[model samples]
Target: EPEVTQTPSHQVTQMGQEVILRCVPISNHLYFYWYRQILGQKVEFLVSFYNNEISEKSEIFDDQFSVERPDGSNFTLKIRSTKLEDSAMYFCANRLRLATDTQYFGPGTRLTVL
Candidate 1:
């Protein structure tokens, strides 16, 4: 079966540099989402995209963050400036629909800032 894949399973970055976390979602999936888990916190939704535009986004998706489908299969999330608080596991997920959707997640990109 096809699955979502994320790059650099673990990333260590400086506190002020930019980072682009990459993901390749399932080929036939229609909806894509970005979520982050801070060590002991709940998974927080960042953004959701479909049809090449943002469908929904949470407050966590601020000016420093952006996402794009750079190609047919690759989806990317860019953080303009990282912060120490940005350390977390960033997960990429995809599903077939918005409501009643069952999403599949990548192993996750662990971002470490120092």
Candidate 2:
């Protein structure tokens, strides 16, 4: 069995700095997504990407945020400028195929903005 992977399990950064979170989804999954959970808060959807374009996005994915699939196996999320409020655990998820909606989630990349 295969699973999603995220790099730099933990990250610490100063406010106004940029951060890029990386993810690798399951080998055959077609739908990819990014979600975030602030400490003590509920998990929130950030954006969804398919076929190299965005399929859906939440308000949280504003001008400061961007996502890209730089290669066939890797997906990335970039935050242009970090804020204290941006501190949270970011997760990556992917669905096996278009026939099903089931998504497998990655452990997560924790971002701490000071």
Which segments of candidate 2 are over 4 A away from where they belong?
none
Q: Write the per-residue lDDT of candidate 2 for residues 1-114, one digit (tens) a residue.
A: 788999879999999999999999999899999999999999999999999999999999999999999978899999999999999999999997765669999999999999
Candidate with top TM-score is 2
Q: How close is candidate 2 to the true structure, as a TM-score?
A: 0.96
Model 1: lDDT of residue 10: 94
lDDT of each: 0.93, 0.94
- Global lDDT of model 2: 0.94
Clashes of 1: 0
Q: Give lDDT for model 1.
A: 0.93
